[model samples]
Target: MNRFQAMAQIMAILCEGDRIRKGSQKYKIARKLIAAKIDRMGPEAAYSKAKWNKYELFVEIEELLKAEKAGKILRNYI
Candidate 1:
């Protein structure tokens, strides 16, 4: 199996494990973190490839990664 094969979409993005742009990586404390993939993104007709304004990324990843799957990935992205 490939690396992301076992990881939740949100988990892989979190552990992109590399340096990334500001908005995609870190965020302000008050605002809830979110991850979404844009498709045909350059046009006004573009839409989300991955659920947006939904994942709500968190700080604690270890716990969340173990328990994350199905529709529960969001609540546990911590």
Candidate 2:
């Protein structure tokens, strides 16, 4: 995968790991670090793409977990 995709995957994995460990604060800290890295990279589209990728990845993982929880509820009722 390309740099942006790689970063997204890395961030997604980190987010999932944090969730497993019940580390909400750490996850927020990681997001801030990602934002800072993006800022340090400069205000170009190329740099911004990585930042966006990280945000999207976080959202995707969060949605996945939500869906999983919903599925579990459905399974219990069905």
Candidate 3:
């Protein structure tokens, strides 16, 4: 999934429950995205054998989303 979609999923989880703190939002989203990808790729596909990973990609997105100055929620909005 794209970064926006990934972020959307994380936001949804954030609003879903108090059990999950915002600090773990990235991990939650990464797990969810990986599961979704595995589903789309078919059950035969295994994450262990995958050549790429989402956590690294999410790290890049997090850096981009960091505020350069005064900003809240989203840094760059389309």
The clash count of every prediction, one per candidate, is 2, 0, 0
**Candidate 2 per-residue C-alpha lDDT over 1-78 given as tens digits, one digit per residue, 9 for 90 to 100:** 444554454456555534524355445444444445444553354345544575564554465456555564322221
- Predicted model with the maximum TM-score: 3
Summarize candidate 1's per-residue lDDT along 1-78 as a digit string, tens digits: 222332244334444544223344233211222222221232121112222422343333323433443336543332
Model 2 steric clash total: 0
Q: Which prediction has the highest lDDT against the true structure?
A: 2
**Candidate 1 colliding pairs:** 60-78, 61-78
Sequence-dependent TM-score of model 1? 0.19
TM-score of 2: 0.33
Off by over 4 Å in 2: 1-10, 16-23, 42-78
- Report the Cα lDDT for candidate 2: 0.48
Each prediction's whole-model lDDT (CA): 0.31, 0.48, 0.44
RMSD, model 1, all Cα superposed?
11.9
Cα distance off (Å), candidate 3, residue 38: 1.1
- What TM-score do all the candidates reach, one by one? 0.19, 0.33, 0.33
